[model samples]
Target: MTTNNNTLLCWHSKRAGVEVLVEAIKCLKNRRVLINRAIVLVQTDTDSSLYLNHEFGDIGLRFITASLENPANHNEIYQRLETSVLPELKDVANLHINVSPGTPAMHAVWLILHARGHFPSGTKLWSSQFNPDTKRTSISSVDFNVNTYLAEISAISNSEGSYALYGVDPKSAARREALATLKEFAQVPKAPLLVLGERGTGKTRLIESVVGIVKQKKVVTLACGGLDSQVVDSMLFGHVKGAFTGAETQRSGLLREAEGKVLFLDEIQDLPTSVQRKLVRVLQDNHHYYRSVGSDKEETSDFELVCASNKTIKELATTLDADFFDRISMLTITIPPLRICREDLLDDWQKIWGEVNVNPSLPKHAPTSRQLNKLLESSSLAGNLRDLKKLAFITCAYMNSYSPTEALSKAICSLQAFDDIEENEGTKFSFGDLSNTTKDELDKLFKYELARAAKRQFGTWSNAGKNLQVDQKTLQKYMKNDS
Candidate 1:
């Protein structure tokens, strides 16, 4: 619906076409005067001019096109801004964006960017909603001032709100402050950042957040601790053909892809010592030049580095040189463990539990708060959010196939099994005293757990086998032994 004179930007809704949008605008026009000009954003596949604008004869709502199958994609917002909105708004004196006629995500993008003060100086935001009782729709131009923008941003990004900012709510003051810092960091041209946290405490998740919320040339990641030194080096720095016995292809590395953007190196403590030195050199000289393992020619990749580790800067300094650590430890952010964040734990637990219980993909079972508390209290999650998710998965599996009590028992049993295996120094398990099942059942259970662990650790049997010092063929055979 068009409200202001200069420009009105909106996405074409498959459900409610421009005719309905025009009807809504007409109803709003009954109450007050309307704008004369507009610029409608449309997908490449859609001919937004098919209808509706014809009826608004005096008001020419010009159509601008961008290719977007999913309006919800954050990338679409950038595409829209670049290809449509910014180009159209160059000389426009005022603007009003009607977000009523698009996808929920489209509406959110409009509201969020405007709330973040991204639009032209006098741009106003409004929504047109049809009223069944009144059989009419009217323009509700939000005050769209600094006061409402700030207030609405907090409310909209809060847990209870319909739209979460990048799918996360900054509930506490600390988290809110961290989010602010992250956003600011995202805007900077280049800066090294460090995130210290336990596994699954959202170090990688924040990297994703930066990609979504910030405009970057590109974003790439490397799991520094997960690969062999040579493999890691080849992945980070390109290798020429014949670099090593198996190096047959001259491949471009992630560093090149990350050039002029963000390069997230996860588990930075495990990064190779040689790589650490090279990285320090990059920071020291503000240049990223590397030679392929066998090639004499040097290559350059100018990128901002962000590193994450489950160790503190002090702990890292013991293993890494002071210079390397100092360059990396420039801007460090620590994620507090869930165990210590008692204030937010219950809320987090409730949301997680509710999601599991209500999911149509799983059998429905309402777990009591007290019962859930027992599971949480007994779990040695050690503040890892992934553990809570794993527990939820286990609970659902048991609730679907067995019982809640059985779920709780299995959850505790799995933890005990891990402890026993660790104490036994990774020796084959002994099912002698385990009274729950026959040999066949025990074998099946072991296979199931092994498969699950392998998937989590390496995502493929071959990688898992290599990590576990077992042959991939052996793992494949074990998987075939059945569930």
Candidate 2:
């Protein structure tokens, strides 16, 4: 049978496989039309072969088969597609390659083609049947829809409002106060806003809730961490066709996508220096222009920018260019960490536990008076609300396997294990466990807990110091002094 290497085949027999293939095809078709003819690469299995023959045969689609009994034979099939097939389709504009669910040979073929850059530039690769129930799909490169997935997950996991903010009372005062503020904020004339907090402090949840409150606005979220300068620039500012490498078509960036809406940026501190400068320009002038990939024309767009970060603005300013910091307005709201509001643990626990899928018969165990006192007194929460939720989940799992008393005992044992490990490794002493602390010395206690938690999580002073939101040199100084 004749095959085209530039034409990729997606092979799947079941519903889940087909769904993934459809989604993948949708993503590709939205970008460009494939005309060189494509095939669904299927195995020699009965179901797949029959499906291909009966269901897709009339469509004039091609089917390439490789032996499933011996995965090693896939190399031969790959050679045929690469050497014999792709050469024939060289004249086809926008030659592309894709593969469906099949043997290891299919994946190998893709990897070889990708390494050799044989596929068309800007080609989006996908894996089929990643999670059928969740309707989850994986794309090789980041796309606008990736933010949509993050927003969807955040919405689903948090819809039940199971976790309470740190500083709020669950039922009466705190809940009422927070909700009142949120409602008021929603009613205000829409403008650029900023949410500031330490890592894992539920800033995203608060921002999402606010977005929901502002019903008329579209929310486009972006994480600025670990992205390349060029990608970040293109993502925030629409790029024209041929603007850069792999830019096959003109595309609107998030700023344009979120016009007359909210552009929520997470980890704003990680935005590159050049992008930061551009953003500053946008904020100050309320208008900015972006050059298309290969076009000479520049497009101007406007939008509301909402930025969130774990780093303090002062600290971020030190790392970023002055012009960027100058453009960011001083209106900021800080979300307190979980340890500050130990009184709301029960409400938070109940809220989160209700949303989790668990055995219905599992008994709900509220913390005992003594346990509450101990938890309130302890300060080992390294990751704020995120850590607390994880602890709650672990506690719930343990409760399923044992009685409340037993589960509490297990938790105590784990906390003690943390202590034992620190002692064995000659880590610094914890101030909370120390005696005779005056009011003036209480701040030192908080610092000790922060440092200890950072060290435990990172296993080294330097990394732990980063988590503690301090410099490595300062952490070394603290370690050397051994207060």
Candidate 3:
């Protein structure tokens, strides 16, 4: 593959100047690697690229200005390469990335990008080393394996500190194993990855962290739940000006917006079968492309597809189109629910507490460790991370106005009462099984508790109403009845 290398891509080092690039070119030439074009990343504030361009202009030199004074800014560097560099090199089949120049951070970014499969299949990463004994520089391809690298670093990332980076506390063996699986899956950049987890099991958070590493841009997300066939099709494949009745001007769609990034389809099992068939073709192979709703010309978008569902693969198979399900099931990750990893409850509670305390919109109040521990032990966390966070928010609200002891007391009682209502939510309540008066009391109690929980979850009554699917007046009525 190196024999067909027509592009020499590298970053210009300030200290080494153009010597590193020149040495790499010489070594490539010696190795019979044809360099028809040289793409160099130079500092935006420097004229060094002009001089280097003057010297290498005959070799089709192209300069990409990078504001990389602080080479440690990996996000900026990765974005620049994704938006500017990679697009330019898409046509270069056998590209070579010279890692001889730039800072240590820059070199790491290249390896990460390559290991994560951001580079094309035939791309080579070359490293040049100077041999003092021979008074010459030799070039060699870095033999880095993505799976092997992930294995070597698994030990380091298995700790609580690393998991905390993703706003999760994987304290149990099951959670640690799940995280390891996720890290390995992240190495396969383009393969469609499916995440299976119950509600409030942190599936979205896990995807965010994994996608953050593989792709440095924000994920483009579309919730497929409750969306009809036409809506899903127009959203994913976009539409021309007159494609649909109310498409307005033109819609580029989530798939187009997700080019060079990750597209997370939440609750993917809910996607209509008609749209699922269309996606099978878009996700099949290297030549995958999609046609817009009203256009015949095929359009291409290069993106990583990540799907998530609360249902298991078996459940998904029953509902999804066979081919579409098979295509997206290329890689799967299952996250154990909080019930299985109950040991993480306290840690998860603390993390939520810390976030609530720091939130600028919430009244800042610190609770004693003893109070927090007492509250955690007394409250029910069976609802998973969501319930634990809600408990923390409610406790924080109490602490803002009440004594620490009183806040703990109120929080425990509230959670226990809420848990009772939730536990009995689906049971039959005929007059023989339960009196009308008792049923009315439970209904009223459940409504008040739900209203209060919503208020705590969302800072304002308006937001609470919108999220709870109730009108502001209804929520106000519930609050008034409670008072």
Q: Each model's RMSD to truth, in Å?
A: 17.1, 21.3, 18.1
Better of 1 and 3 by lDDT: 3
Candidate 3 Cα misplacement greater than 4 A, ranges: 1-169, 359-382, 428-483
Predicted candidate 3 versus true structure: per-residue lDDT over 1-483, tens digit per residue? 255547888987777657777788888888888787888887774745445444764477778776654677887777677657764654466688988687787888898777645554567899988888998888998998664333223322332244322222255788888888887787776788899988888788667765555455568889999999999988998989988888678888888998888889999989999999999899877556999899888989988889999998899999899999999888998988665565565556545555555456543333445645644443435566777667766776787778766776687678767976875673333224334466666776667667666654554566678887899778877766543
Winning model by lDDT:
3
TM-score for all models, in order of appearance: 0.52, 0.51, 0.53
Q: What's the true lDDT of residue 260 in model 1?
A: 76
Clashing residue pairs, backbone N/CA/C < 3 A, model 1: none
- Model 1 scores worst on lDDT over the 10 consecutive residues at 158-167
How much is 467 displaced in model 2, in angstroms? Answer: 27
Candidate 2 segments whose C-alpha is farther than 4 A from its true place: 1-190, 287-295, 363-369, 415-483
Native-vs-model 1 lDDT? 0.64
Estimate, for each residue in 335-360, the C-alpha lDDT of model 2 and write its tens digit.
65555445565555544544442555
Model 3 residue 316 CA deviation in Å: 1.3
Q: Name the candidate that leads on TM-score.
A: 3
**Compared to the true structure, candidate 2 yields what TM-score?**
0.51
Error (Å) of candidate 1 at residue 399 is 2.2
Shift in Å, residue 193, candidate 3: 0.5
Global local distance difference test of model 2: 0.57
